[model samples]
Target: ATAEKFRSISPAEFFYRNKEIAGFANPARALYQAVRELVENALDATDAHGILPNIEVSIERDSVKQYVYRISVKDNGIGIPEKYIPEAFGKVLFSSKYVLRQTRGLFGLGAKMVILYGQMTVGEPAEIISAAINSRRIYSYRIMIDVRENKPIIVSKGVWPNNTGWHGTMVKVAIEGDWSRAKQKILDYIKRTAIVTPYANIVFKTPDGEIYTYLRVTETIPPPPRETKPHPHGVDLELIKTMISETKAQRLIDFISEEFQGVGNVIAERFLTKYGFDPSKDPKTLSKEELELLVKALKEFNEFRKPRADHLSPIGAELIKIGLNSILKPEFVDAVTRKPVVYEGHSIIVEVGIAYGGSIQPSEEVVLLRYANKIPLLYDEKSDVAWKVVSENIDWSYYGIVFPAPLAILVHICGTKIPYKGVGKESIAEVPVIEKEIEEGVRQVARSLKLYLARKQKEEEMMRKAVT
Candidate 1:
């Protein structure tokens, strides 16, 4: 059997073999995911820099091969530095989003996967043009991924004269896709994205010469989330050790106070006393057994205050109203922004909105629009935690909602660490605390819907009496 050829593959090689896990299972899904990943990256870049986003996406079929399509995304955001552009687009698992903040792209694999899919299917390098914000110089690169080695293979790199004074990034890739089959899904994703991120301006040119634009309703960008220290309950043994190694605090007590939230001089000293450890001992000098004991103490300690919410940037109730109003056009609309809650020591906030009557048509089932960190979750609605909470936990009939009722439910979860079910990030994982918050948020809005329906019923009764 050829001497049992077996060797460990690089991250790129593994993903190349199992592209389905990264949301490129088929041509149709691949096409949709590519657009989503790129658009999300664009949004993140702009949001991080506090700039209003202008994004343009275009898809065109190959002249010779109808199945092959050229996909291009342009964004007016903070562009990648010239040197980092190749690796940023070409290397797998390379990312700058490794901080504790609410961002759309968490794993750092989305855009790279798009490049890999394009290269695997059409054997074409990605074309990139970028200019840093406030810079007049522009840089362009033609780069492809070396899947076996997980590195960027640059085909060409050069500078271009900037005439329009634009500062942002533009990415182009050629890949095999069935746009005809993926058209509706692609459009729906973009529209839902616009609904969630009303501050963004998006324009799409489809393969069939269709132009769709979602204009920005407001220039006000939501406040960017601030990075925060890890919470005591959120850290594990491995993370504890890593923090101990990297922290600059000389004493164990100081390290705890400086590295973790909810830890101060008093709390840190108390923890040391309870654990029978020297508060003055150098944290780096702790032995393996001592570190293990510290981890245990952290897990068992209940006196620690819940994680803070400064790291979370939830979509405000007013913005949710504006977004729903622009799209759903419902007769009655109500929104709730839940207070921040802690789960596994990480602070999370959930926002819920309800729109009833008017343009919203009643359906056989509830329409739940789920979002995580302001990015719309388009697929796997049936398996999401929010879906389960709405369908299984909430009794809609008590809230004056019935089958085919003209209603829509919206839920958004923002956190330092969202519990996503898998790499695809399509559904939120069912955590008890998260479920409780979601339930409470929905109920808050459901109560408003109930009142509206009750008023409508009373009005109808009065009309009947008047006619008699």
Candidate 2:
């Protein structure tokens, strides 16, 4: 091939072409992701009302043409207003939900992407019907997202004549794809969703006519945690450069001190000391070359491991209590603490909590899933060092460890960033120090359990001996 053929395509075409990458392998998987996005949106809506939500999903096989099916997910959530309907279902489709806290949908592209996938596979537009509580009517629209053209085409729009009040969003998509390959993952997603969102009731109907429903016996849903801002130590060279460029500060030291909240004079001095640069020195006097050297030194300082306590924002004790109580139904709550513990030479923290003496198996007594930030890492055991350590340390014989058992040990890891092994969010690369910290923490908790068991055994033996 000629050298000219090896050149990269124009950025415009590259972006447009790559946008369709979500469809190549299995369009069913993409549909699944889309369904999750819409469901998450619905959940967020109801969550805003501080009410536990009821989300319903239905799959129907349209046998008019083989391999054609319609999937619909409806929720009792706050419906979109008339003015924002077009934006919700059409252009500006990305990131309908935006917050600093860890959430499922950031790009707001989930529901929109579903429409795109539907159009691509079936060559037909998807249907949307939504209504607000205050509105007297429901609005229905048939919409198609033209990815090839980068525009949303409106096929039809009408008002649903419903005198009875209603508030919810219903999206129906017709797509040409087989459902067999996507069955297991859909089931697992529902299961995990049900497990984590213990208060949200979910119902699903498969294409095969199998009906599955997850009902919450409790009325409590974990409130969305507070948002976390970017700490000064976590920002890299590019961020620092951006800060310098956008900031209107007359002096560099003032910019560093005022714009960045955490970097005080002492921390700034420590950072500058390594590069033999003094923070007290005036930034205006420095040339471009000197500024470059300062930026490089700051980047190196950012790489140094900060204390885990200084950086981590773990899920609070109250939220964990809400989750544990809903799942385990614990009667006598003992203790819950999300503390940092040292493992090896590295700085890693393990969020370990206990809900002991429950009416359940000790082995399967609690839930333990490691999280980097607040995202769930659901995957293989080998990659889950937290799982490995807990399994190794806990005495399973006493509790009769079993799958789908009652009681769970909820353990998570919060680092500046978590390293994943592959595309799967479940498998994570093990940091030796972090793993050591986690294992040691598990062992310590296990030791407490062991001591409690020993003491009980001794007391029982003494009573029996005295009676005999």
lDDT of every predicted structure (CA atoms) = 0.89, 0.60
lDDT of 2 by residue, 230-265 (tens): 445445556566666666665556665666545676
lDDT of model 2 at position 169: 80
Q: Pick the candidate with the highest lDDT.
A: 1
Candidate 2 structure lDDT: 0.60
Reference-based TM-score of each model: 0.96, 0.67
Model 1 clash pairs are none
TM-score of 1: 0.96
For candidate 2, the per-residue lDDT at 360 reads 46
